[model samples]
Target: MSLLEHLEELRRRLIHSVIYLVVGFFVAYGFHEKIYQLMQAPITFALKKHNLPTQLVIHNPVDGFNMYLKISFMVGCIVAAPLILYQVWLFISPGLYKNEKRYVMPFMVATITLFLSGAFFGYRWVFPGSLDFLFAYSHEFRPLIEVNEYTDLFLTVILGLGISFELPILVLFLSLFGIVSPKFLWKNIKFAILIVFIIAAIITPTPDPLTMCVFAAPLLFLYLLSIGVSFMVHPARRKRLKEAA
Candidate 1:
């Protein structure tokens, strides 16, 4: 395809993705209350555990509606994630061989599964722990968390973890395209570990080492897994090495 055609195709895919997201947004908005409750559950539980107030404050007159809208948008993205990933695959599949294009289903499934798993992990484990740690300071300063601020932080952690969990899939694609190799990843393992810890520290909501470790450990494992996946799928290099041997 010409450059213009490629650009047009990308535009089309983006339009489709937007349409899907809009549809998902309306659907999610219909259940915005429930979604907000779910999102607030961790903080609520933490507050209860700490004997603090369970309610979050809304400072502005429009804060309530804005928070609902934000929650709806976030839930919509989660709902449309599979379709968005499918559009991404379709956009790139033109460059892939027929056999490679057949992996689209697996790619979409893995992407969605890993994303949801990471979001769930953040909500279930990390968010509660972080909230507990933060609320512990309420004795010094009264806690009156705003709804918008709370949701913003909540979504940031969830989305960050969700994207981080895609490390293996990203490496798999790079290896499949001969862009990276298992040996290269292994040689850079130390640097990768350092970067992973740095990212974990940045993304974890709490300053506690335990929370940071919780975030880093899985990422470290995923990096190792990505190396194994790269080794398995890099048949061209493997064949070349075999011939040399």
Candidate 2:
């Protein structure tokens, strides 16, 4: 393609992405109050469980309104994610082979599923555990919590989970490219587990083992799953072993 063609394609995709995000933003903003309430549940629950009278307080005067905007924008991005993915696929799809194209639908579905699942896991399981742990530790002291600080923690965990859930896709991409192999991964399983804990330790804000394990376990499982996928790519290894036998 010529430079003009590439530029045209770029412009087209950008326009589509922007449209999707704007639509998402509007829809999310509409539900911003409900979303904020929903997000605050875990922290509130934890506080209640500990019998603490304190609620998250806002030091900044504008925090309450600004937080709603941030929450709405986040929701909007999620609402528009499919369109963003489609636009991304559209941009790259023209370059893919027939076999590659065949994989696109499944990949698209899997991408959304994994991302949602990760977000869900964080919200459902990890959130309460983490929130409870933190609040429980600090409850006796009764430190004033800022709304921004609480919101930031909530978003950061959800974002981390969303990113972490891309494990299968990352593995598949690496396997497709032949950069990593099943045997090589299997031989380095110890290192992989170590890496998983190291990553969990680095990424998670809380030092509680349960919180760390909650994040690390799935990542470790993904590494193992990646090895399984790598085997499918290297069937020649099986044939070679058979010939040697």
**lDDT of each structure?**
0.88, 0.81
lDDT per residue (tens digit) for residues 11-64 in model 1: 999999999999999999999999988888898898888788898998889999
User: What lDDT is reached at residue 235 by model 2?
Assistant: 42
Q: Give the CA lDDT, 0 to 100, for residue 117 in model 2.
A: 87
Collision count of model 1 = 0
- In model 1, the worst 10-residue window by lDDT is 233-242
Residue 63, model 1, lDDT? 98
Top-lDDT candidate index: 1
73-159 per-residue lDDT for model 2 (tens digits): 888998898879888788777765454577678878988998888889888988888878887787668767788888888888887
Query: What's the residue-level lDDT of 118 in candidate 1?
Result: 87
lDDT of 2: 0.81
